[model samples]
Target chain A: MMVYVIKVGGNVIDNPVLLEQFLADFAKVQGKKILIHGGGKIATRIGDKLGITANYVDGRRITDAATIDVVTMVYGGLVNKQIVAKLQAVGCNAIGLTGADANSIPASKRPVKEIDYGFVGDVVAEELNISSVKLLLDAGLTPVFSPLTHDGKGQILNTNADTIASSLAIALSGSYAVRLIYCFEKKGVLRNAADDDSVINLINRDIYQTLLAEGVLTDGILPKLQNAFNAIESGVKEVLIGHADDVRKNTTDAVAGTLIC
Target chain B: MMVYVIKVGGNVIDNPVLLEQFLADFAKVQGKKILIHGGGKIATRIGDKLGITANYVDGRRITDAATIDVVTMVYGGLVNKQIVAKLQAVGCNAIGLTGADANSIPASKRPVKEIDYGFVGDVVAEELNISSVKLLLDAGLTPVFSPLTHDGKGQILNTNADTIASSLAIALSGSYAVRLIYCFEKKGVLRNAADDDSVINLINRDIYQTLLAEGVLTDGILPKLQNAFNAIESGVKEVLIGHADDVRKNTTDAVAGTLIC
Candidate 1:
């Protein structure tokens, strides 16, 4: 069975029209199962509205109590459903998931003792329940994920979608043909943020880090690249970082964005 | 000083046109506020298309690993942003949130060790941060939330929107005038679900059980009524269960729905 894992970025998620378009394209991927992982952009937006200032320390969202309430409502509630609706509208079988389901992605609190960060979590793949994934894929449903998860304890923590995608890819290591698709605007990861045409085609961990060091990969690309590395190391076959529009282009000759091997 | 906690339902959220209409009415509500809840129907639609059978035990979704992934994308990614964009389009400064940010809602995994119900979570309210709510309200912006939360560990879980709403109402009890406007197809909590005219004017905890016992209320009303009761008892001044059409009406006199005292 062919299983493709797509990691959608916060920026793409912020744009519903673009996301809708991506869902349409996702429906066209024939003979393969699809899985999606999304970030908390919507949660962030609601947090901003509710006077909840989200402080990201060390690339992790520092969630407090009030913020957690809003995040739950937006990420798992509104945004998760909307994507499912879009997929279904165009006739794609989509299933939505969070870290809590099946204990799929075993997570724990970030362990920041001083900040009192309420529900922030990190993914632990080894302890995840991968059987649930096999069951869904066996039945032929596309899995879409939110970045919420829990430690074995009752505490559910906020997780990064990319990290979830990576951990999930590893947890289901030999089960599915996992491909991480980081969809954003600007045609892919450009050498510079301003140029859309300068998409980087392929990179290993070394080149990815080098670009990061050289400041060629900036903004959102940095976290995504790191996730790409993590995913590849975790067992995902190919990590495709490209424009949401270029998802279908078959290319051994390089398409758009950076591809991590 | 006036903060309205509007509980927009999954049904309304499933239909984009209805969602837009809801947003239009929602924009009319003036206050430093937060929108708390999730969209399940939309997720269900996606699940159905994907051939994933969704099982809900006691109104809570039973998620498998793959289902969790699908839900996260749909809720955290699509539905949340669509609402935010709609709000923004209408000039309503709205932001979306998931539980991870600011530890909005401290979540823990459902501790039923024997039952392998994947990804469901419960809230631990004390861990949430309310400072964001204060800031957003101060800035005259509204927060739209999705029901995805974390348990402080590294896992993200799916949570009930009502639970999140109640928790937030209690958390923000000291400050805002928290009123839950549960928008649904029903006119109000009918003395009988079949009779729209027989709306229950006021329901105290004692009388609520009586209504259920008499077969005057059945089906979904039980949980909603109980949730409303919990909210009021927890300090929310009002709980209005009505159709979206009646949202802008004179809520002071219990316009058209069940008024849980």
Candidate 2:
């Protein structure tokens, strides 16, 4: 059986109109699937309103104690529950989750280096409780995940949605044929960074090497590509990078994104 | 098999020490169980920080638009996840839930009469998707629910935790010998309103009638007793009204609370 593990970002989550359309399309996709969602500006906005300042270092936001609580409420609570309800309205039996639920994704708090990331957690793919996830999927339920993991010591930690998506993809590969999809603002990995139409339809290792040698891969797409290839090496059948609008297509044979084999 | 559906209210929730002690005892109880928690002062505290007002009518808190969103985040998100994590830490395999999750508890928005309690949901016992809940329990996962349900058409509604507890007890009675326990600040149903130690060990319908005729019940305990008797009438094996500290003992043959049969 094939399972689609889709990751949708803050861009889609922040916009009500886009989120509704995306969820409708997502609900219509056949077979087993999981959704990992990113925490949008809503958390930061809510944090600001609550007098919790967002701390940043090297252009990345820090999950301080207060910030972690804010994210836990906004991302795991408000945003996640709202999405689940809407999906149910559209006939999808969606169940929302955090890593803390059922102890599904046990993660370790990030070690301190030059700067402390506070309550951010790093998940090791091998440690995921795939059996519980498989249990839900096998029982005809869709599990929706928030970008949060726990330290197993009663602490919920902020996690990266992209990382959660790929890690889950890699972990579930053993049980099913997995197509990991990263839904973003753009169509796909562009051959010409300036033109959205110049999407690279396919990228095997050979093409990736050639593209890298030619400096065609932009800095923004570098991490996403590296993450995708890592998923492939870890036994995920395929990976797709596409616009949120093309999620359903990316799940099928007529993929409208960068397909990494 | 016996399934205990336990509900703990805001008094325990607002105090960290009390909550930790309660959860440890709850985790140590020796059978299948489910926990439904109340929205504590934390929601109101957080809502105040976020500039959402707490509206009240006739001394009852109203679930207005902003208040519902705040409760969804605080009750379903922050408090629920934290409890799940802590339970996991104590070796209880807890999975946090709202009524919206997995559509386990379907509800309808309360219709307007004298008051339009915005976004408040009233759950019907038969409408609960007990199979999903049974699956999780059979899989050895303990469910920890927040006082949040959904209108089937995409709205998360604030529900009374006591109602949720009794409703689940009634619904699960067909599958298991159900024990519905409501844990609050008091030791048990009191013989004297002024004395905390005046605990009534047991109450049957005949005893209840005599007590009602004598007006032994206070304004606060009347609703709880009524709810408990309703559960008994609906096939629940027993209902316990006790302090949160006595949860484990209340689950056993050597009970420590007011047992209604």
Candidate 3:
């Protein structure tokens, strides 16, 4: 049986109505599945409430020690537990985890290159513990992960949700045919930024490069596509990027969103 | 093999040096074990920082909606993960959990009595999911639980740590001989409030009633002793209340604290 690793980000998670609708749809997916979530806006909002200023280099927020505490409270604690409880209410028996839980994902603190990202961690596929996760999955539990990982030395590092989903898909690909789904607001990767209806049905490596050269995919979408292609190259059976609501609607057809092959 | 359910409160947890020593000693215990922690002081501290006034009638803090959010962030999020990460550093493969995780413990919101305590849960042994916890324990994982539970209907309820430990012990008593230990700063139930060395070695049900009648045990110690006796009567193999440091020292003797019979 194939295992689905669904990645949901701030668009759905930050909005309660959308999150509930998305979770209801997510719960309907059959067989083994995992949910990886990101708390972007909530973390920032909480940080602001706590009088902590967010430091963003380029577009990505740099996680400092105090910011790590806020994210751990918001992402790993409040948001994660809230999702788990809601899933439980919907009959999905979900168990929430941080990287520290079961030492499932031991990442290293990002080295201070030109710009130090503070508490950010870069996860390697080989270092991700698939056995314990597999054990939980085999026992019929849906694992919901927060974008928090530990360095195995004691520090809980804030990580990227997309990276976490891709890493897990790649690591678990050996045992199960893994399908990684990146759920966001868009119906799929759109050809035009303004036109929601212009969903790109498929993007191969050649088309991806062509789009990149054409300046169609830049900024945040670039890294997302990069992670998707990385997962595909690493042996994940399929990767989909699409709307949160369309997850269950495309049960008969596997191509609901932008399919990366 | 016997399973130890050790409940630690904020006194030891709030102090960094004491918490480290306690966790190191806790990691050295033989057989299977679980840690249930309380965050009363920390919750209050955070709540105060957030400009929220803590409402307490008698002794227990009334968990209103805002207070619940603070406790969820502090107890279930920050304090719990910190303990899990620290335990990981000590060579203990600790998995942190809220009551909602794996639906391990389902509780109901406490019904309003003469005084209404909002968002607080009352745990029943039958509602506790021992099988899932046993599965995690048998797989060689030490579960560090936060004092938070869910109502199975999507609400996260703030629970008492001592109650959680007692409920877990009673529920798991069918399979494993459970020993419940409550660790705090005090040596034990002190005969004299001001004397550190005036430890009450043991207290049977009769002595407990007599002590209560004589006004020897009052205020905070009343509920603690009550929970201990409740656990003992519910078929827990043994229950001890003592200083955090003495946990590892009295391994052989098991008489380092106040034993409730």
Candidate 4:
């Protein structure tokens, strides 16, 4: 059976109504669709309420010991559980986990220097347990994951969710049809951020790099393009970048967003 | 020479004035002190403004391909650079990184699962480039790291700051004096969340397991205690769980929080 991978951004989650709409629509998909979500906003909100001030140097939130505690408590503990409940409420059999459960994602904490940021981890994809995910899928349970993971030493560290999806896309690409659906504010990938008419269609590995180099594509657009190329090269059949409204459109159509192969 | 690792919490970072005060205080530290910070709240806020959402499962942020892009732009691109600027403004020569520049944190994406969560990743601490940290410290530059890291696959993944701190502590433990200072809202690790006087001092490995079994701890505290133990086992000398108020206190005092050794 063809399997689709969908990444739900944290912005969608923040707006419960928008998330609900997406969930409702997601449930109607004819085939199996894997869902990944973001919750940094929610976690940070709770952190703020608890008088915790989240810190970022570049763009990464430094997960110190205390922040990891809050993230595990909020993101893993509360947000993940709640997302599962919501999916379940809509009749989606969703299971919740940290990257450590069933070795879904094996990891180790990054070595700290110049600063002691605790509990921030990096993924060890080689050690990932694909069987665990298969088991959940076999059981018809939708796995709702939090970015929280663990180092081999048994410490749970806060990690990124996007990398999780990319890894999954590569892991399942050989066996199943993987579709990376990114729900963003823009209708799709536009040639120019301001001019929607210039949405590019079908980008290969070489062209993607050129755009990135010329600075024609910069900022947030960079990693997405890289991830799309990574997924495509790894065997994921197609990559779809679009807004929430275009999800149901024929993925191959230019209306949906940028298509990368 | 003795080196101590000090982790600054997000709470202090949220309040610019308080953070400035901290920077001033840190400037006065006599010996070599490595600082790590958490910046999730602000990152999330900025992501929201940019129409991005931050998601997590367990404790990991769901970094789908697109989300990873947004995160890198936000965390590594803007936030990390901004922090370096902030520290520099305070006369602290700081260098920012996304863990990829120096291969400081080697990582891999979790295996693709039934569902795709995009670019989420975890750490490979053993493969970390600690020499990069040493180089910066040798030149008197305080390295400020954003939580975004690469999986050694030319992909960047958002990570929790805390795990970064812990891993760094463990890796550097053999060479430098490591002290993990986690400041939070609570004054210290309490025997009972309601009782401030229930502060416990000096928890070893075995007793921590006892506390978990006895249900004396729950939620995020469980993971933190586990991380504390892991750090100690991994060779980190001293771990302190306390409040930001005590940041300036005598580093050796068992003054207000739980001490893990």
Candidate 5:
């Protein structure tokens, strides 16, 4: 049996129509699956409304104390619960969770080097609780995780959703043939930045290195591709990055988006 | 063989020392247990900080859209996760949840009678998902619930923690001998509002109604006592209302707090 670890970003989550469409398609997936979500834009927007300005270093938000509170509310409370309820409405037995819930994932605070990223967490793959997650999956419950982890010292830390998805996929790969999916707004990793239809259908580690050396892949796509390749090397059976609406189509045809092997 | 349903209010949750002490004691409780928590004051404080003025009618905060967002962040995100983490540190495996998780509790939006309570939810006992909860409990996992429920229609509704504790106790009574405990700052139900030591040791239904008629049991204690008697009549084995610090003492002595029969 195949298990999928799907990660969706704010572009799909913030839009009600896109979210509903993605969840409906997600519910149709066969076998065991998990959904990990990101809500950075929503968190920042809510922070702005609350008069808390967001600070970013190298395109990653520096999570301050107040910003941590805001993200917990937006990502863990609002976005997470709303997605679970929507899935429930579509006959999916979704169980929403943060890392602190059942101590499913314990992360260490990121050590400061160049910038002080307050309250940000880095999860080690070994510390992930596979048994508890397997228990939920065995009971036919789909776990929906928010991008939050605990330090096991009563502190909730903001985490990266893609990192979480990849980590879960790598850790669970020992028991299940895991497939990691990254769903967003674009068709996939575009060969040309301007063309929505210019998706690279397949990429190996050599192609990824060549794309990086040629400066064809830069900015946000770099980290995503890095994560995909890392998951593949770490034993994930496959990795796919594509538009949220094309999940079913991509999986069915086995030819959509960028497939990393 | 026995299940304990403990409810703690904001008075304890808002205080760091008191909360740690209480969770330490709660972690020591033998056998299966669950916790329900309230966050009215914390929610109102966050709402005020966000420039959203809270509206109230007959002492219940009208859960308008903004208030609902605030409470969801404070209660479900901040407070719930914090408690679960604390419990984990004490070697107790706690899984935090809102009613929407696993569709554990489905409620209906409260209909406007004389007051429009905005997004408040009223849960019917029949709609409670006892099996999912039992799955967690039987696995030796403690469920820490925040006072939030969904309407099964994609709307998250603000609920009262006391009501949730009572409903859960009533629903689970058939499977285990359930003991419902309400923990707060005070020693117990006091004869006079000012005296902390003047706790009524026991109160039957007749005495409860007589005390209410005589205007002795008024204000916050009234609703709590009502919930206590409701639980008892609904088949819960025991109900206790008292100080959070005295939970272990109360259970051991079987003589602490006001016992409702």
Candidate 6:
């Protein structure tokens, strides 16, 4: 069996039109699948309304107590439930989830060094409750996860949506041939970085090394490519980086994204 | 097999001390159980912070668009997930839910009558999706539902927690002998309104009629008793009105509440 563990971020989440198209495409994808969504700028907007300031240091935003609560409401509650309802409307049997629910994804609070990322969680790939997830999948339920994990000590921790997608792919690889899809703003990993048509069709370890040696990969796409390779190394069958609009096409044999083997 | 469908309202949800103790006891209960929780004053508190005004008509609060979003965040996100994490800490595999999640409980928007309750949902007992719920319960997972439903058209609707509890009990009665429990501040139905210890341990239709004739039932108690009898008539094996502290006991053979048969 093939399972599609797809991730969509703020580019789609914050835009109603984009999200509708993305979810419609997502609902059309066949077979066992999972959706992990990121908390968009709506959290920051709500936090500002509630007087909770967003503190950022070294380019990474911190999840303080108040901020975590705001994100929990926005990501875990408002956005996640709304998406689930919308997916249900589109004929997808979507079940919304947080890591705390069914202990599906237990994580540890990030250990403080110089910066304390207050309520952020760092999930260990091996610790995911795959049995619970597999049961839901086997029963024909599509899980839509909000980017929230719990520390088992009764605390909801902020987590990266991308990390959740790749981690779940690696964990579920044993049960199914998993294709980890990362949906972003661009069409795919662009060879020219500016030209949308310059999407790299296929990249194996050899091609990736050549691209790196030629300085063709931009700093922004570098991390995503690295993550894709890591997921491939960890056991995921395939990794696809593509535009949210291209999700349905990317899922098929006629691919539309940068498929890293 | 006996299944406990328990409901706890604002009194239990608002107080951290009471909620913690109640969850601990709830976790100790054996066998299949489901929890339905009402949105507490925390919604109002957060609503006030977010500048969402609460509108009411002749005492019944209305759920406008903004207010619905706030309740969705507070009840579905913050409160529900928090309870899931706490239950996980106590060794309970709890999956938090809304009527929207998996479309487990489909509802219709309340009809516009004398006053329009903007986004409120009224669930038809038989329309409840018992199969999705039973899948979770049969797999050894407890469901914790927030008082939110959907109109099957991508809109989240505020619902009465009590109604949800009774509705689920009636819907699940075919597969399991359901014991519906409502946890409030009181230990049970009081023989004397002023005496906390004057608990009525059991009540049948005759006792209920006698109590109504004697004017022993208060305005609040009357509606609850009516709901209990309605549930009993609909197929629920037993309906227990008890204190949140007595949840574990109420689930046992030696019940600690007013058992309405």
Which model scores highest in lDDT? 2
Instruction: Write one digit per residue (lDDT tens) for candidate 2, span B1-261.
Output: 899999999999999999999999999988899999998899989988888889888867889888988999999999999999999999999999999999999999999999988889999668899988999999999999999999989999999999999999999999999999999999999999889999999999999999999999988888899999999999999999999999999999998889999
**Candidate 1 C-alpha lDDT tens digits along B1-261:** 556777777878777677777777776765556776576576776566556688877655787765665566567655665566456556566656666543456677788765767777788877666665565566565667787776555355788887787777777777877777777878787876667787777788788778767888877777777788888887888887888767766244536666778
Candidate ordering by TM-score (highest first): 2, 6, 3, 5, 1, 4
Distance from true location, Cα of A38 in model 4, Å: 1.2
Which RMSD values do the candidates have, in order? 18.4, 1.0, 1.5, 17.3, 1.7, 1.1
For the candidates in turn, chain A alone yields TM-scores of 0.87, 0.98, 0.97, 0.90, 0.96, 0.97
DockQ of 4: 0.02
Candidate 4 C-alpha lDDT tens digits along A61-154: 8887657656765565445544554555455655555565444676777788876566677778677766656655654656666676666443
Model 5 per-residue lDDT tens digits across residues B15-107: 889899999999999889999998847777778877899998987889998888788778888788888889988888999898988889899
Q: What fraction of the correct interface contacts does each predicted structure contain?
A: 0.05, 0.91, 0.69, 0.00, 0.72, 0.89
Ranking by lDDT: 2, 6, 5, 3, 1, 4
lDDT of 3 by residue, B140-219 (tens): 99999999999998889999898998899888888998888888888888888899899999999989888888888858
Query: How accurate locally is residue B252 in candidate 3, as Cα lDDT from 0 to 100?
Result: 39
Candidate 5 off by > 4 Å: A253-255, B253-255
In candidate 6, which residue ranges exceed 4 Å CA deviation?
Answer: none
Better of 2 and 6 by DockQ: 2
- Counting only residues 3 or more apart in sequence or on different chains, how many pairs clash (N, Cα, C under 3 Å) in candidate 3? 0
Global lDDT for candidate 6? 0.92
**Better candidate by TM-score, 2 or 3:** 2
Better of 1 and 2 by TM-score: 2
TM-scores of the candidates in the order shown: 0.52, 0.99, 0.97, 0.49, 0.96, 0.98
Q: Please give, for residues B77-156, the per-residue lDDT of candidate 4 as tens digits.
A: 33444344445445565545556644567667767776555675567888776765665565465666666556654456
* Candidate 2 local lDDT, residue A169: 94
Clashes of each: 118, 0, 0, 87, 0, 0
The pairs that clash in candidate 3 are none
The CAPRI class of candidate 3 is medium
| Candidate 6, Cα interface RMSD | 0.6
